[model samples]
Target: MKALFIPGNSPYPIFSHAPLATAVRNAGHQVLMGGIEWVLPNIASVGLPPVKISPVSMEEVGAFMGAMPEDPLDQLKAVGRVYAEIALDSLERLLDLADHWRPDLVVGGGMFYTAPLLAHQLSIPSVRLEWDRIDARMYDPGAESVLAPLLAELGLDRVPEPDLWLDVCPPSLRPADPVPARTMRWIPGNPQRPLEPWMYTKGDRPRVYITAGTRLFSGDALRDMARSIAGLGVEVVVGAPENVAAELRDQLPDVRIGWVPLDVLAPTCDVIMHHGGGGTDMTALNAGVPQLVAHPEYPTEATRRITEFGAALLVDSGGQEAVTEACRKLLDDSSYRERARSLAREFTELPPPAEIVADLEQLVAARA
Candidate 1:
């Protein structure tokens, strides 16, 4: 059977979908991943056949969405609208591809609204893959509000719910009321580079890995955080995109600044500090590294759950003192590491991607 996988426009969510898509394809079924031009490289990196469904990049959509609001609710609304706009822009091309490809199933990333619409239009099953522990449906109200007209245009009242929702969140970090989903282990599929000795090996000093994620962060803030982390007598490795790494090269002569793959770097680190993007957060958690998240509550549910689980701490500001104190606390207090390792153990107990694929086949066969 043929399966079409549609992930979010951004690189992180696309990475989140890779493990399962690869699993399905390895099971001797055809898999085609659809994305915008901006994320084609990310799709290709996962060794999947990519079909570019839209010329627009996520940066263009972010420009359309304008400034992100400080209020988390408004931020969710804005994010919802952004995904809706992406769907609106790509729907035609997506439908055209669907007509030609005729996939028996469509597996969508958590926030990619277009996947459900495509499945509904084609009368096929759609599966929703959670990018993290959070229930992504929290953005639905905002998305559906903007999507109403398009729904009317398509003669549908609402986007159909997926036949299966795969949850990759560890049970310990899951929200009190999560969407009903099948538990699947989150196998990190972070893009890799040729590894050097430093990446895979740990030094005598405690090692800390800091990343702002693909969404990017101000170099000044990252520099301050790096310095603060370094002051604690730990080795600091700053993982960033090329541009950010270039900006930091001279400023942080003593620190390691480059694209260090999380799957490789995270295991060696004593602690992880990042912007709290779902992929980064889950990666460190899976690696059993205690985290120092910069935001107080952006990805609401996951942020709240992780802190409450005592695996991570929230740094309210980018102040150097705050960064140092948080990192020090994560390093000094052993409980955080214990909790993180507990979550990592939970991940091992969950079903692997291949098992999820077998279950998916059964679901599809029953429907057929």
Candidate 2:
């Protein structure tokens, strides 16, 4: 069978889709990926399967970003609008690919609005692969207000729901509002690279892993947060790009700095600190490591659920003092570690991606 995987025009969504695509391919199905050009390099970097780039340009993405309003609600609406626009822009290429490839199934990233529409047009079954629980809101009440015009252009009345929704988030970390979802074991799909010898070695002091994610980039606030964490008398390792690491190096002369995949780094650390990205949160959960999330703007559902589960602490401002205090709690408290291990046990009990492949095959066959 041929499966078309549509990833969002961002690294996170692409990363989320990789392991599942691997599973499908291993089950003797052909997998074809689709997305914008900017994310293609990152997808290749992570060693995802070959992709067919959409006609959407970087300039279009830039314009979408620039047009975002200051209000959070407005920002969300704008994002929805852009998602629709990208879907519209790529409609022709995607349709052409579908005609040639004749895929039996479509697995789409939650935010890649084009996938479901195309699948509906072709009368093929589609499924959703979500990065986190926030995807539950994709079809919420006001979604039509943002998506209707685009759907209308395609002669679609509404964004058709996928035949299945793949839930990677652990039950303990899922959102309150329930949706039609099937739980799939969470697999850490961060890009792999050569690991340094020191990464495996235990240090004299407690170790802490800090990252603001790739999108946070660099700023005085982030640098100060790193500096303060480095000063906390613990062994500090900062995961960032070379340029960001260089900037942090000026402030933190003795801290370890480099781009190490979270899957490799999480097991070695006592506490994990990050920007509350779903990938980072799930990685920490899988590693059975406690977390300190410094998410000022968008505190994800995973952040809230993890904190409520007693495995993580949230720091809203990304302030030095707040993060330091949270890190201290994570290291000094035994309950945090205990809860994290419990969560990890729950995660392990879910069916692995390889096992889920059979289920997906059955679903496709039934639909076909």
Candidate 3:
């Protein structure tokens, strides 16, 4: 089978789809990445080479997010309008790629990358790929629910028949609030991150991992956190990307700072610090370490939500004082470590990635 995959908005695609692509490729299918042209660095950052197909420029979507008048509702309305425009642009590109790749089916992870619309335009089946509960149920009446009705009004069908709305989030993680059942499915994700060296080789002192990712990687806060923790006599392994690490490293020269892989670094560390991307949350849980999170909500929605569940610490990840205090508290508290381990056990109980992939493949086959 050949598939053209439309990716999510954030860097999640790199970790999420990059591994998924490798697995699908190993399964004997050709997969073409379709969202790279819009967010090129995101593709390049994750080390995925350019795919043959080009995506509609994300400039309009960026502009749309930029030009929206501050209100959340207005921003959402703007998104749906811009979604239509972007979908049209994506359709033109997909049509051109189809003429070349001629994929067996088209699959997208998350919204409006034009997969469903593209499939609609090309008379082929398409599935909306969901990674978070928010995107999975964003169409209902609650916070962040606006896209479905708006899309319906625009005459674009958001629903896929024969039960096609699907998600990668595990059902055990679903909220108590009512959720849409038809379009949802449990799909576990693992990027198979290369484990870092320091993890397997334990040091005399306990280990702590720190990263705010891109959303709220305040240089000052990170440096203070490092300095505060470095003095605690524990070995701190930070996997901060180049941009975030530069300033933090300058402040905490004593701390071991480098681009250690998460899969490798996470399991080694006794605890972690991150802004809470879903992938990061899962990684930390799987590694069975305590987490300290600090995100200010724009791109931090995933972080903030995960924090509310009590699985990790919602450290302010902001001011020097907040970072310092949060780190010290988590380091000293035994309860935080206990909760983290419990969450890791639940994450472990979830279905493996292969079963999740089979669910999606089955959905597509059943549709056909």
TM-scores for all predictions: 0.94, 0.91, 0.75
Candidate 1 residue-wise lDDT at 185: 92
Q: Is candidate 2 or candidate 3 better by TM-score?
A: 2
lDDT of 2 at 144: 66
Candidate 2's TM-score: 0.91
RMSD (Cα, Å) of candidate 3? Answer: 4.9
- Give the number of the best model, judged by lDDT: 1
lDDT of 2 by residue, 265-288 (tens): 788899998876677878888989
Off by over 4 Å in 2: 46-48, 57-68, 136-146, 153-156, 213-217
Relative to the unseen true structure, what is the C-alpha lDDT of residue 251 in candidate 3, on a scale of 0 to 100? 70
For residue 279, what is the lDDT in candidate 1? 81
Error of 1 at 268 (Å): 0.5
User: What lDDT is obtained when candidate 2 is compared to the true structure?
Assistant: 0.77
Ranking by TM-score: 1, 2, 3
- Report clashes for each candidate as comma-separated counts: 0, 0, 4
Mind sharing the TM-score for model 3?
A: 0.75
- Count steric clashes of candidate 3: 4
